[model samples]
Target chain A: MRTLLFLLQKEFLQIFRDKNLLRQILMAPIIQLMILPWAANYEVKNISLAIVDHDHSTYSQKLESKIFSSGYFKLADYCASFNDGYKLIEGDKADIVMEIPANFEKNLVRENKQKIFLAVNAINGVKALVGTGYLGNILNDYNGELRLQWVQPSKISPIPSIEITSMNWFNPGLNYKIFMVPGILVFLVTMLGSMMCALNIVREKEIGTIEQINVTPIKKHHFILGKLIPFWVIGIFVFTIGLTISRFVYGIIPVGSIGVLYVFLSIYMLAVLGLGLLISTYSDTQQQAMSLSFFFIMIFNLLSGLYTSVDSMPGWAQIITDLNPLRYFIEVMRMVVLKGSGFHDIQHQLIFVIIFAIVFNGWAILNYRKTT
Target chain B: MVAVQLNNLSKKYDKGKIVAVDSISFSVDKGELFGLIGPDGAGKTSIFRMLTTLLLPDGGSAVVDGYDAVKDYKAIRGRVGYMPGKFSLYQDLTVEENLNFFATVFGTTIRENYELVKDIYVQIEPFKTRRAGKLSGGMKQKLALCCALIHKPSVLFLDEPTTGVDAVSRKEFWEMLKRLKQQGITILVSTPYMDEATICDRIALIQSGKILSIDTPDAIVRSYEGSLFAIKSEGMYKLLNDLRSYENTLSCFAFGEYHHIAFRDKMKNYSEELLKYLENKGHKEVEMMPVIPTIEDCFIKLLKN
Candidate 1:
């Protein structure tokens, strides 16, 4: 234990001495948290729409006005013919086009039915999909209004319909920042924990200080703990900074117990730091350790369910996410911050992370060689 | 009692494609200063690394401070202090911090073993606050030696400690080693410079992973069995070629200002005949004298055989 204290002291002294590394650690979280949540938004907007109205009828104008007022789209062109609108779509100036056939009001009033065509540029798939969905909803509402107006009170017959209403429980407004901040915070902490610790030991190796360390009487666990504790502290410091930014800058407050969140974060740090140390043990140089770290962190970040819902992934992919440490942290962060979940709700995730902590740390300790 | 021992130990690199330390055996008695003398790539560092438990031996065994190297590695590591050929101290750390760190990890305090490193550490103590990387090469070496000695292990393994140091610093380093030996610390130092061999109490002349001879420096030089002479002349380069072509010349190599040559057979008036031959070859102001063999001369003679 005394030996561990001395080792920790040396590590901290070195860390503090390196000004560039100190700046990187303290500033990375603040800068990334402030910028990433806003840029990585999934809510698509500003879709460009082209209008081709053959009939200058009031109803056609009303539909055109309705689409323009929806806030999700901007008018790219107002063309007189379908071909003119089609040209806007082909030129990539418009994301969608709406065409109303000639005599549209005549058919609607005489036959009580009308048809309209919508052309979506499917090249930008998300914009096309969401834009078409929005247009469909507007046309349905317009049709319902027409029906209500055309029916007289005496001739109206009862018709049955099912209307579905969804209440977004956690994020009622569906603010992308609210949904993304907690996950991004978790990712930032994981990155700081793993990459920094991975490079620490390998730097000693490259500088040849590790040989001096290896020849000493120090126990393997003491050495590993000495390395693990300092980075774990740095990881938590970065986590706190990220959380503060989310709360003050984004107005996000965790509804769950702060104690529960900290407990999970502490355990999660061990798992990540252990993984970093494991990489450090297998590598001979800092460059090799960094590349290996990049490989794993990349895979973990993508499969972490931060950007995409884990449930929506294919079965094989979902199974792979079960092994990712980041996936659990992101889930727990959201559950605690957004869902107001307590320790009881996160027990399963906590247990899995504890297992990861054990497996990774134990494997690292076993692989660390005092003599080879 | 033996402080360090190796019996038929061997190490191979690249899956046996290169033999770093062929099967060899030697030992250093307790409190004796031993030297492994050889040029670079002659397996001096390999021997030190294996003894310090930093490397595993491919064949046979090594015992350090009464503990088996492979099986009791943990025990060996505690008792041995190694200074690798490369300076292995933390460059980013100040000298005092580096020393304190090594002391603490060895379960000892600087005050506890202060006496052991006092002579060496005091030399570098004035610059303790400066970071090690900023120190001059000689100061860096002194600090490294102090860190290794902070724990005051029973056996000290220093590999090429004076290889790149200045002449004055090298002389001081050897003096410090002499002082440490007086304190009854068994020191095993390796060097590529043949002149440094005389400082060791005993040395093993190693070449190509094999021991050419192992003895006291004086005894090794006394074992030379040929008439050796130092010869000098105008046109030193041409003199070397002319002497090698002579019928009686067995070996010729440049040694500083003069060339040292050995004769296969020395008859009466052979020196006068050799002088006449060199003059006929357009050599001027030639000088020749029989000289005593040094360790280098003995080494070359042994290598020739």
Candidate 2:
């Protein structure tokens, strides 16, 4: 215990002395937490649209106003010819072009049906898909209103109408930031904790300090613990900072107990810091450790269900997430913060994380060679 | 009793394609000052590392202070003090912190063994507030030695501690090591410089992962197989060329102000004939005579053998 205390003291002293590392741990991550969620939103909006109208009738004008009023698109320009609309798209003035046929209103009123053609820039595939889906919803509402107007007020309904309503529980407003902030917080903590511990030992190796350390009587387990405890404390401190920012800046207070979040975080950091130490043990230099850590972080970011629903992914991707440590924390964060879930609700995930902590840290401790 | 004993210890790199330390065996007596002298890549550091329990030998065994290196590593680690070839102290930490850390790890305090390191530590004490990395090369060497001795271990291993130190600091470091020897610490120091070999009680001359000779410095010098002669000429540039032309000249090498030469067979009147030889090669004002061999001479002779 005395040996570990001295080791910890030395480590903490070095950490506080380095201005760059101190800023990275305390200041940079907090700033990232405040700003990154604003950009991470996936809600498509402010799509510039151009319209080519060959028909100047009430029905066509009403449909045009509906698309603009839906808040998904903004009118860039109105063109009399397809050539003019094509020019607007090519000139970067519009994201999509809509064309109405000459007899669009006449056919809609007489034949009871008319199709409007659309051309969209598909360079950014997600924006194009969501914009088209919003357009489809607006048209559906217009058709329903037209059918209701044609039906006589006093006439008996020919068929029984089934009015279906969707009440989105938990998140009624569908604010993407509320869904994203907690997940982003978990990501930052895991990344900072792992990367710090990963580079710690490798930096010692590069600077020749590990030779001085290895020749001492310090036990391997004590050394590993001393290295991990400081970063573990930093991880919790960062998480608290992120939570306070979420409450004041983003108004995303956890519906469940904050204590429960910290409880899970304390254990989760063990797995993260262990994984970093494991990378360090396998590498002979800091550059190698950083490269390997970047590789694993990229994989974790993609498959952790932070941005997208994991169930929506392919079977192979879902299988890969089973091995990912980040996936469980993200799941628990969303459940407890947004869903007001308790420990009973996330017991399985907690158990899995406990297993991960033991395996990852145990593997790291074993891989570190004292006699190479 | 022996403080350290090795039996055919060996280590190889790149899967035995490169033998870093060949099967070499030697021992240092308790409280004896032993020096391992060799050039770079001569396996000096490799042998020190293995004996200090920082590296495992591929074959053979070593015991330090009544403990096997492989099995009793934990016990051995606490009882041995090692100063590596490179500056390994924390660059961000002050000198005092480095000493305190090492002392604490060994379950002792600097206060407990103040006498052992006081002579060397006092030299660096004025710079105790300075970061070890920021100090001069000589100051860093003294701080490293101080930290190594802070625990008052029975055995000490220093690997090329004076490689980059200036001449004055190198002399002071050797003088400090002699003082440490008087306190009954078994010191095994390695150096690439041949001149440092003379100060040790016994020395091992090694090269290319093998030991060339192991004995007292005088004994090693006396074992030189042939007589050596030092010659000088005003045409020193042409002197080396002219001396190799002599039929009886066995070896010729330029040493500082003169060229040391050896004859294949002992013969009289050769120096006289050599004078005429240099004069014919546009040489003038030549001086030639016999001189005693230094450690460098013995090393080169063993290398040639």
DockQ of each model vs. true complex: 0.82, 0.87
Summarize candidate 1's per-residue lDDT along B1-305 as a digit string, tens digits: 99998999999999999999999899999999999998789999888889988899999899999999999999988888899878889999999999989998999989999999999988989999999999999999999898898888899999999989999999999999999999889999999999999999999999999999999999998888867899998799999999999998879999999999998874434788899999899999999999999889888887888
lDDT of 1 at B114: 95
Query: Chain A of model 2, TM-score against the native?
Result: 0.96
TM-score for chain B considered on its own, for each of the candidates = 0.98, 0.96
Residue by residue across A1-372, what tens digits does model 1's lDDT show?
A: 898889999999999999999998999889999999999887768989998888899999998888879888899988988889889989999998888999999999998888998999999787889899999999998998888787665654666556789999989999999999999899988888988998988888898998999899988888888899999999988888888999899999999888899999999999999999899989998899999999999999999999988999999999999999999999999999999999889999999999999999999889988777
Error of 1 at B176 (Å): 0.8
Candidate No. with top TM-score? 2
Give fnat for candidates 1, 2 and onward, in order.
0.91, 0.88
Fnat computed for model 1: 0.91
